[model samples]
Target: MSVVGCGYLGVTHAAGMAELGHRVIGVDVDAAKIATLAGGRSPFFEPGLDELIARHLANGRLRFTTSYEEAATADVHFICVGTPQLGDGTAADMRYLDAVVETLAPYLVKECLVVGKSTVPAGTAARITSMLRVLAPAGESISVAWNPEFLCEGKAVSDTLHPDRLVLGVPDEQAEKVLREVYAPIIDAGVPVVVADLPTAEVIKTAANSFTATKISFINAIAEFCEASGADVTVVSDALGYDARIGRQFLNSGLGFGGGCLPKDIRAFQARAHELGVGQSLAFLAEVDAVNLRCRERVVEYLRKQCGGAFTGRRIAVLGAAFKGGTDDVRDSPALYVANLISQQEGEVAVYDPQAIENARRAFPNLVYERGVLEAANGADAVAVLTDWPEFGTVDPDVLGEVVRSRNIVDARHALDPARWLRAGWNYIAPGRPALQPALVGTV
Candidate 1:
């Protein structure tokens, strides 16, 4: 099997396939990424990926290449390239997907199965099918399948190795047979499979992510009511989570979803809906998008109040830069957005993350970078924990309290205990939670 486009999705999937005892070739246009993977090193940060690459490359089950010849010889190919949101933020940019198909389709000289694992708008698989039929030397004999990836960034390795379910978008029985064999090891391990037609498979990913994003925005939108009514969002979510129908997966009432997938997927889904003339059906997603963006702005607003109504020359330490914990992906990171907002307002922002410092520095060159949380907090007026990394949740509040000029903490991701920070001589502020009213900031 060949896993094309070795970014977060492809690299992990390649390593995962090799782990399941398949000879897998990792392909990418980026020479550096190919080199890094070929040498058993992951170019990006994902938990346990380096170990997987090392183990597989040692056993010769995994390899990396930039040539299309390596991919053409494989019996199955997985298209896992990025489908980023368009520049205008109106639709998904399919240029990368198109380029991959254009480059690889001509090399198909046999009956090979082309599986697409990227999160794309509905009908993308059908479009790719049309392109392959026209371009492939193998003609209409080759099969194209849609198998959208369900891997999460931080837990990507595990997610691929032990998926809850497998969804295959197949054009015919042959496509399904090819996919079943490609994933035989996983199926033997008891992972259920859901088979559907081409277009349905395409919608599954977009629809799933849209619903998850909506759940996140739903809780965030309700948390606003909690803020206005002096209610505790934690308690509200805790009770709401008791209903089996409403699980507690993305229910945390904090800075909303932002990563490579969720934000862009929801927007792309909306755009596709609009294109299909059902725009009004998923219209609430616009609010979900707005609410997600507003969470970051609200953090900025809270910081403004914490700064006594001015941001100029104020010192703020922001903890966490990746969109969420466990991965170094900074695309559309809310933490970086909030930090950039504060810095733009003339605040002295020192940002730190456990694993995302390098990527964050590259993404936001103007923001100050620090090595450790305490270093970022040093001499700052307040600290905002934005990305929900576990370390930030467990960091000693007293130590951070001593580092900052004012013991003010904004738990933007709801990742810290307000009682702990307050007891440690710090003012705890968070969205959807009561702020550090002067009455509540008295000595413990």
Candidate 2:
């Protein structure tokens, strides 16, 4: 089997197939990335990724390459190239996916399945099928199938190994049988598997991301209302989750959604819906986008209130930069958004994260990068916990209190223990919950 585009998804799929005892070839255009994978190290930070790659490399089941011909010669090919949102923020740039199709078409001799794992616009699978039919060598059989991946970045390996569901869009029964056999491991594991037409599978991936993005923005919209009225959003969200229809998974009412998937997916969906003349049906998504943007502003407002309506000279510290913890990707990171806004203030802004500091530095060169938690918190009038790193839970509140000049903590991610911080005499504020003002709450 061959996996093209060896970033997060490509490397992961390659390692996963190798773990299942298949001989896998990983291909990418970037020479450095190929070198890194060939050296038995993941270029990015993901738990268990290096060990898995190293194990596969040691056994010789996996190899890295910069050639499309190498990957196209395999029994099956999976295209994992990125479909980044276009500049207009509505359509996906299909250049990479198109390039992959164009490159692999000539190499086909026998029947082969070119499975698409990238999240693409609706109708993309059929479009690619037509392209493949046009580009493949004469009399060579080629089938294009849509097999969108649902792996989250941090737990990508486990998610791929045991996905919640598998949706395969095949043209006919024969294609369906082949796809099922290809995914026999996951299918036998009792993962909910759905076989549908090409367009349906394409829509499934975009729609799911759009829904998750909308759900997150929905709670954040309420958080705006909670700010105006004296209602605790956490309690309201908890109450709403009691209904069986509304399960409490992505009901988080914090800094809203920002990462590689949610923001771009919704925009692309909205764009596609407009093109299909169903724009009014998804108009609510625009509100979701607005509500999400507003959450960031509210955090800045809260920080101003903490610093006596000014941050001209008060030192502020920002903790965490990755959009979410467990990955080093800083694309559209909420933490960086907040850090950039805070850094604009006359006060010094120190930023720290266990994994994302380098990526954060690249995106936010103006912000002061701190080496340790104490360095970030030291002499700061207020410290904001922007990303919810699990390590944040273990940091001693009393020690942090001693480092900061002022014990005012804004728990933007709602991750830290407010009571512990209050006991240490720090004023703790969080989104969606009533402020844990140290003066009001007992310091026990």
Candidate 3:
């Protein structure tokens, strides 16, 4: 089997397939990335992925290359390229998807299945099928399917190896049979597989992302009400999570969703819906996107308030630059966005992340990057924990207090224990939560 586009999705999928005992060829247009993977190194940060790739590469089951010709003889080809949002509009840029199909189609000289795992707008699979029909030398012998991926950033390795469910979009029994054989190990382990047509499969990923984004924004909207009502959004979210129908996932109300997936996926979903003439059906997604962005601005305003109502001449320490924890990806990161917002206001910002500082530095070059949390917090007027990294939550407020000029901290993600910080003589604040004053000496 061959996986086209050696990115987050492609690299993980290729290594995962090899772990399932299938010989895998990973292809990418970037020679540098290929060289990195060919030498058993991952270009990006994903927990357990580097080890998995190195294990497979060492065992001879996995290999990477820049040439599509090396992938020509594979029985199955998975399209795992990225479909980022277009620069001009909210619509997805499909050039990468198109290039993959056009470049790999002519190499299909034998009966093979070309499966798409990239998250794309609906009806893309059928269009790719048509392209392959015309471009492939084997003509009708080539089969196209959509097997949308559901891997999360931090937990991608676990998600790939032990998926809760698999959605396979295939035209016929043969394509299904081929995919079933490809994933027999997972299916045999009792993971349910939902077989649908091309368009339905394509809709599944965007729909899932949109729904998750809506869930996150819904709680954020409630958090806005909580702020006005003097109610704790955390308690409200806890109460709401008690309902089985509501559940607790994506219900946290601090900083709203942002990353490579949810932010762009919802916008792209809305754009695609507009193109299909059902724009009004998903109109609320526009508000969902707005609510998520507003979370960033809300944090900026809170930081300004912490800095005595202005950002000028303020030194702010921002902990966690990744959108969320456990990944180095900073694309559309809310934490980075808020940091940039503060920096734009002339705040001296010191940003730190366990894994994302390099990526964050590249994304926001003007902001100061720190190697560790303590270093970022050193001499800071205020500290803001934006991303929910576990280390940020466990940092001792008293220890952090020793190095800062002031004892002001904003728990933007609700990551720190407010009672602990307040007890340590630090004024703590969070979104949708009341600003609590530091405990007086000798007070319980």
Candidate 4:
């Protein structure tokens, strides 16, 4: 089996396939990235991915190369390249997908199934299928399939090996048979498989992401109303969770969704919808995107008030930089966005995260970074917990109180217990929640 692209998705998928007892070759254009994986190390931080790659590499089941030629002999080729959003518009840039198909087409010397695991707009597989028929040497023998990946950054390994469901988008029984054989281990484990045509499988991923984004933004919108009506959003979420129809997932009202996936996926989905001439059906996604962005600004507004109405000459400590916890991916991170906003307003912003400091530092170099939580909070006029890392939730508020010049804290993610901070002689605040004053000294 061959996996194209050695990024987060590619590396995890390759390592996982190797672990499942198949020889896997991970191909990438970047020599440095290939070298990193060849050395049994993941280029970026994903929980358990490094160890998985190391185990597979030691056993000789997994190897990496910068050349596409190495992938020619494989019976199955999985296109795992990314489709990041275009800079000029909301539509996805399909250049990576195009490059993989064009570059690998000439190497198709035998019957093989070319499976696409990347999230793309509907009809992408049909277009790629047409390209392969024209470009491949073994035109009639080549086949295409869409097997979209449903992976969470922190849980990529587990998700890949033990997926709840498998979606196979194929043109015929031959393609379906080939994919079923490839994922036999997962299928054998009772994981349900949904077989469909090319476009359905392609739209599944985008639709899922868009719906998740809407749920997140929907709760955030309700949080806004909760604030105006003096209702607690957390309690409201708890009540909403009681209804089976509205199970608690992506319902936390915080600095809303941002990562390599959700933000760009929703925009690309909307863009594709418009291109399909049924844009009105998904028009609400535009508001979903807007509400998510507004959460960042609202957090900044909360922090500014905590800074005594201005950011100038204030020292602010920002905890957590990764968009969400459990991974070191800082693409479109809300924590960094808010931190940069404070820095731009002349506040001395000190940022810290358990694992994302390096990536965050590279992304936002102007913001001061610290080695530890206390270091970032030291002499800070106020502190803001933007990302929902467990470390921030468990930190001793009293100890943190000892370092800050003022004990003003905003739980922008609603991750901390307001009672804990208020009891520790600090003023605590959060969106859609009333401000709470510190408990009297010597009182529990």
The CA lDDT of each predicted structure is: 0.89, 0.85, 0.90, 0.90
Candidate 1 accuracy as TM-score: 0.97
lDDT of 4 at 353: 95
Better of 2 and 3 by lDDT: 3
- In model 3, residue pairs whose N, Cα or C atoms come closer than 3 Å (at least 3 residues apart or on different chains), thus clashing, are none
Quote model 2's TM-score.
Answer: 0.95
* lDDT comparison, 1 vs 4, better candidate: 4
TM-score of each: 0.97, 0.95, 0.97, 0.97
Scanning candidate 4 in windows of ten residues, the lowest lDDT window is: 435-444
In terms of lDDT, model 3 sits at: 0.90
In the predicted model 4, the residue pairs found to clash are none
Off by over 4 Å in 3: 435-444
Residue-by-residue lDDT tens digits, candidate 1, 227-259 = 776777888899989999998788899888899
Q: How many Å off is the CA of 32 in candidate 1?
A: 1.0
Q: State the lDDT of candidate 4 residue by residue for 128-176, as single tens digits.
A: 9899999999998888999999999989999999998999999999999
Instruction: Residues 1-444, candidate 2: write the lDDT tens digits.
Output: 899889788899889889877899998999998999999999998888899999999999999999887777787889999988898656788899999888888887768888899998888888888888888883227888888988888999999788899999888887788778877888888999998899899999988988898889888877666655657778888889998998887888888879888888888888889988899988988888888988898788778778888889888898888899899988899988988887787767899999999999999899999988899999999998888788877789888888999888888887887778878887788876654442222211
The 10-residue segment of model 3 with minimum total lDDT is: 435-444
lDDT of 4: 0.90
Clashes of each: 0, 0, 0, 0
